[model samples]
Target chain A: MYVNATLVAQLVVFFILAWFTMKFVWPPIVKALDERATKIAEGLAAAERGKQSLELASKRSAETVREGKEKVVELLVQAEKQSQQIIEEAKAQARIEADKVIAGAKAEIEQEAARAREALRERVADLAIAGAEKILRREVDAKAHADLLAQIKQDL
Target chain B: MATTGHEAAAHVPSAGDYIVHHLGHLNTTGHPQASVVDFSVINLDTLFFSVAMGVIGLLLMWVVARRVTSGVPGRAQAAVEILLEMVAGQARSIIHSEESRKFVAPLALTVFVWVFLMNSMDFLPVDLLPMLWQGATGNEHAYLRVVPTADLNGTLGMSIGVLLLCFWYNIKIKGMGGWVHELFTAPFGNHPALYLPNFLMQMIEFLAKTVSHGMRLFGNMYAGELLFMLIALMGMGFSSMSGVGGSLMWAGHVVAGTFWALFHILIVVLQAFIFMMLTLVYIGQAHEGH
Candidate 1:
C-alpha cells in the first residue's frame, strides 16, 4: 500500500496506453462516425432531389396528356367540317348534270316534230293537185297552181 | 508471517492474522515487510494484475476497432459503439478543445475500463486466486490481492497520472509563467499580501483533490475486500460447528456472498465512472484560465 515502484510503473503504463489510444484508436472511430453522418446527409439530399424530380415529371406528363386531348378535339372538328363541304359539293355536281340531260332531250324532241310536219304538208299538197286536175281538166291551171302550192307550204 | 506450505495452514489464523495476510503484497524482494514508507519495494501482484487488466482493456478496444463497420453492427460492435459514443459525449461536454479531446477522451475510456476490470476482480471469491497461487507454487500462505483498485498504491498511481495531465494542460493552455502566477495570485487576491495564502490554498486544493480521488476508490474497494474476507471467515467459523447451525451458516455465507457480489457490480462500475469523470473534469479545469 505504500508509495513505491508499482505506482511509478502504473503511471508509465497509463501514459503509454493513453498515447497508443490517441495515436491509433480514436481517429479511425471518429472518422467512421463522421463518414456515416456525411453519408446520411447526402442520402437525404439525394432522396429530396428524387422526390422533386418525380413531382416535376408527373406534372409534365399531365400537361402532355392535356395537350394531346386538345389536338384530338381540333382534328375531329376539322374532319367534321371537311365532310360537310364534301356533301355540299356532291349535291351541286348532281344538279348540274341533271340540267344538262334535260336540255339535250328538249332539243331532240323539237327536231323530231319539225320532220313530221314537213312530211304531212307534202302529202296534203299532192292530194290537192289530184282534186284540181279532176275539177279543171289537164294543163290550163298548172302555171297558176305553182303560186298556190308555195302559199300552202308556207302555211304548213 | 513469512511461513508457507502445510506448516502455515497447520495453525488456524486469528482475525488479525487473516486480515494482515490478505493485506500483504507479493513484493519483488519475495516477502514485503510492514513499512509505512518502502520506496524500493514493488508490489508484484499490483503490477501484474494492473498490466494484465490494461492489456485486456486494450485488446477489447482493439478488437472492436478492427471490426468496426459502416454496415449493420453485430452485438459486440454495437456494444462497443455505444461505449465509444458515451465516452465521446462525456469528453465533448467536459473538454471543449477538440485537440485536447483527441487524447483525453481515449484516456478517460482507458481509465474507466482498466479500473472497472480491476474492481470486477473482487467478484472472484476472495480466496480463489490466492488458493490457486498456494496450490501452484505450493505456498500455503501465498499473498496475492486480485483487486488492483483495492491497493492504495494502485489507485493513487492512476490519480497521479491524472494530476500530471492536469499539470500538462495547465502549462499548455496557460503558459508556465501564467499558471505559476495564477496559482499564487488569482484565487484570493492579486495583492502580495494574499499570495502566500492563495498559494497555500491552491496546494491544499490539489493535494485534497488527488488524495480524495485516490482514497475514495481505494477505500470503497478495500472495504469490499475486507467484507468478503469477513464473510468467508463466517463460513469458516460455521464449518467447525455441527448440525443445523453449520448448515445455516453455510447457507448464510452463500447468500451473503451472492448478495454482496450482486451489489458490488454497481459499486465497481460507478466507482470507475466517477474516477474517469473526475479525471476529465480536473483536466478540463486545467485548460481554463483563472
Candidate 2:
C-alpha cells in the first residue's frame, strides 16, 4: 500500500468536501443557532418588562386607593364643619327673634298703661268738680271757680 | 483458514500465505511482487473504499443540513448538532483565527467522519468482502481490502493532505518569507551557522509529525484487521476437524471476534478524533509566529 494517484484523488475530494461544507452547510446551521439564542434573549427581556409594568401598575393602584381614602377623610371633616356653622347660625337667629318679641311686648304694655292713667286722671277731675259743686250749694259762682278748677286739674 | 477463491479450490494455504493474501491490495499498477513502497502502484481497494466512505460521510452531513431546524430537534438532528458542537469546540480552542475556522472546522469534521467510516469497516468479517470480490470476478486471487485506514497509503494520503494544508496556511498567514525565515531560526538561536541545523530540524519535525500521524492510524487498524483474520483462521482450523471440538472453535471465534469488535469501536472513533485534532493543531501552529 504505497502512495500513488489515489493520494491526489483523495486530496481533490477532501478539498471539495471542505469547500462544500464551508459554503453550503456551516452557515445555515450556525445562523439557526444564533437566531434561537437571540429569540430566547428577547423573550426573557420581554418577560422582564412585563413584570416591571405589572409592579408599576400595582403601585399606582395602591396610590389611587390611598388618595381616595385621604379625600374621603378631608370631605368628612369639611362637612362636619359646615353642619356646625349652620347650627350656630340657627341658634343666633332664634335668640335675636326672641329679643325682638320681648321688646314689642314691652312697648305695647307701656302704651296701654299710659292710656289707663290718662283715663283715670280725667275721671278724677270730673269727680272732684262734682263734689266741689255739691259742697258749694248751688251753681254759685262755678263760672268764677274756673281758675281753681284749672289749678286742681294741674294738681291731679 | 479463510482462503481466496483459487486457494479454496486447491489445498489449504500455509499461515504465511494466508496472511500475505490478506495483506494484498487490488492494485491499479505494478505486480503483486513489487516492493511495498512502489510509488507507481495505487491501491485500488483503498481508493474505492475511502472514496465510498467519503461520499457516505458527505451524504450524512448533507441530510443533516437539509433537515436541520431551529426549534426543538429530533434525535438525528440532535446527534448531528452535538457532533458539530464537539468539532466546533475543538476548532475554537486550537485555531485562534475566526476566519480560518470557516474552512478548518468543516475540514476537520469531514476528516473525522470519513476516517471513522473507513475505520469502522474493520468490524465486518475480514473474509467477507474479499470472498465476495473473488466470487464476482470469478478469480480466486482477487485482492480486496475492506478497511481503508488499515492500508498505509490511505492514512498517509490523508496526513499528506493535512501537511499540505499546514504549508498553505503557513504561507497564507505568515508570508512566504516569514515562514522561510522562521524555518531557519525557529526553536534555536538565529546565528548564521545554526540556520542549516534549524531548517533541517524543522523539516524533520514536519516529516515526523506527518509520518507518525499516518502510521499511528495505520498501525492500529492493520493490527486489528490481522487479529480478525487470525481469529477467523482459528475457526477454520476447528471446522476442518469436524467434531465437538469444531463447534467449540466456532463459539470461541464468535466470542473473541465479538469482544475485539466491541473494543475496536473505541479505536475507530478515537483514531478519527485524534487525527482530526492533530490536523487542527498543525494548521493552527502554521498560523502562529515562531
- Chain B TM per candidate, please? 0.95, 0.94
In the range B80-160, model 1's lDDT, one tens digit per residue, is 778888999999999999989989999998888889999999998888888788789998778888988998889999899
Please write out the lDDT profile of model 2 over residues B132-240, one tens digit for every residue: 9988999877888889899887888888888999999999999999899999998696989999999999999999999998999999999999999888877776646
Error of 2 at A54 (Å): 3.9
Report backbone clashes per prediction. 0, 1
Chain A: TM-score in each candidate? 0.75, 0.73
Docking class of 2: acceptable
RMSD per model, one decimal:
3.6, 4.4
Q: What's the CA error at residue A79 for candidate 2, in Å?
A: 3.4
TM-score of each: 0.89, 0.82
Error of 1 at B75 (Å): 2.5
Report the Cα lDDT for candidate 2.
0.84
Give the alpha carbon lDDT tens digit for every residue of A49-143 in model 1. 99999999999999999999999999999999999989989988888888888888887888778877778888777676776677778753657
